[model samples]
Target: MKFVASLSAAAAALGALAMLPTTSAHGPETREEVVKFLDQQATAYHCAPAVAAYTAARKRSWAQKVLGGAPIADQNRFIDGYFEAKGLDGEVVKKGIKELEEEGKRIMACDPVVESKIRNSTCVLAPQSTEGPYYHTEAHPIRSNMAEWQLGLHFEMDVGVIDVETCEPVPNILVDLWHANATGHYAGHPEPAPHLRDEKPAASGLRRGLLSAYPRTNHVDTFLRGALPTDQNGVAHFVSTFPGYYTGRATHVHIKVHNEWSVLPNGSFTSGNLVHTGQFFFDDDLNESIDKLWPYNTNPIIALGRTRTRNWEDSLQIYQDAHDNGYMPTFDVEKIGGVLQDGLVGYITVGVNTSASYKPVWNPNSGRAGGVVEQKPIDKATHEEL
Candidate 1:
């Protein structure tokens, strides 16, 4: 992995390479550009390995594990020995911290809300929740607008990204999002369940549970699912509708962050390290307000007189996410138009370590992998050099 000497040479080389739909308007358009930026970033931020070690240590400590999240000084102590053990000078980490402090002051002087939202962006090695049953590696198009005429209140999301190790904004990374419709059904999955009662099952013994046997997707609908790249400011904007509640889970949205991924000819992606797999939750008041709307009020679970799960009641996943180390996975939402009937907008800053890696779990029930860590080489539309 050789680094380009200068941005001028990298830009000249990128002039001949093809661009993909996942490229941000202001971000790197080719793999060479991304690699160049990463090479420069690596020189300044060397705390990724140290942060990963601290996260693992926290999981092993019974006291820290019981308390949920540890203090900042305690976490710093855990990583203090890492630099000495790896023979890295401590001045590098100090320099990175000084740079972040300057940026934080500037952002605070500009807008307090922006600075406050990203203040706790720390690296989390684990996923907030398990990738639910409705995930597919192929056929997810790269676009901003994911709403395909689904009847519900409009939802506009602006997701901010930052490297937790250095607290610096991360650009050119892919943010993949998907959620349920107003009727509590996900697109491309028309199978009949307690929520979706229209289509038949793809297999005979497919059941509904986190550990139950799942079935492969039988349809090709990609509504309410899409991917977008972060701009120079490390933000990805998406348009959709507020998701309705499912049988066992609260109203939430699924998200995944892809680093160094390649776009295929079919508009899907492959050969990337999945750095983050998490879910974002909504406030109870907002979910309650949306529940009284027209289409959301007509869910099959409501028709069947079954109780919908709330955030507090969904203890296993939601509780862990809310109290997890350095991760605030809930969105801060507000009314977009004068009334809630028109639309809503939400914002959240996702903290991740770009250098960290995780393997995608294999699900024998569905015959498909859970998330993408890396895959075999293929012909990329961007002509990306893997």
Candidate 2:
């Protein structure tokens, strides 16, 4: 994929651009001027209301209410009130307050026009880091004639836990899953052609039996959303093939977790709350090979790197951290060269139990406690971080 200059640099440039006051509270029309005006409005309001207020109260009297107050004090008070209302304790509230200060500074630095645009629309600077070959086929449909091999791209990943305060992994947690098929396609897309059922007499295909066959085709509702169970060693595995690249993003898998707490209405077990959202990658050779083709070439995030294995480890670590707080893990896959495609593996380890008060509904079949269970309490002998 063609690489754009670093997103951080772009943000820095935007920050610099924000400083140029090309437009006054009232001024001539120019792109720079428009951007400046928007930035100013953003600094004043910090939200859509600020922009609306600036526009409506351009007469200064309203401007004072939107911009003239003791901003730092007001911000502190607002954050305090927010934390209080949210039932956060002193530490969490303090952390949130600090984050707000940082955000406030970023907001203050933005050109009013840029800030206004951000508030008014979903536009923002591009990301500094790569996210994925995420699926975005809502607009066009994949052709059915695409060969199965051409359509399925393999993705593999690992999962684990994190520290709630710093968002880093603790250790030894299992992640499991299933995902969409290749061709950047998923099941239940409203347009159904590749059927997912079996009515004929004994026609079977690989990965197309049981769960695979019940939904029949990858195009039908089977690839992306099954909750897999973890084993005693805190590891889970899936047999999904790779997924194809999509525009603007990289290839990735979506996964949810099931822990000691997850339960179901029928007394069976469900997975734990989701813990991460990340992507897995193949080696550089694989990326280069894929980049030589279409779609993948157009993606901006793909890049050649010498330390792809390191990158893989780093990415997996991040996924584990994201899930530490009981959130599902999401990750991307980069097909590198020379890796074992068939046995591509991912791992995760849980750390300190952050879900102290989180009570999971009990599932008798899953062998977990509590109609609900929390992470804090564990079987001491096992030392399971859960």
Please write out the lDDT profile of model 1 over residues 141-216, one tens digit for every residue: 8889999878889988777666755544566889999998998878866555444444432333322222232254
The TM-scores, one per candidate, come to 0.60, 0.32
lDDT of 2 at 266: 37
Candidate 1 — number of clashing residue pairs?
Answer: 0
Best by lDDT: 1
What lDDT does each candidate get?
0.57, 0.32
Q: For residue 162, what is the lDDT in candidate 2?
A: 32
The parts of candidate 2 lying over 4 Å away from their true place are 1-178, 190-220, 260-285, 290-343, 346-386
> What is the per-residue lDDT of model 2 for residues 1-386, given as tens digits with 9 covering 90 to 100?
11122345435646565555532211224656444543433322222222122211111221134336323122321212223322223244335435454443344343334432223211111111212222222211111111234333343333333333332223333343333344334554422235533232122321111122222223433334333334332223344454453222233444323233344553234434423323333333444454444543443223422211222223213322332222222221222224434323333232223344333332212212223323464444443454
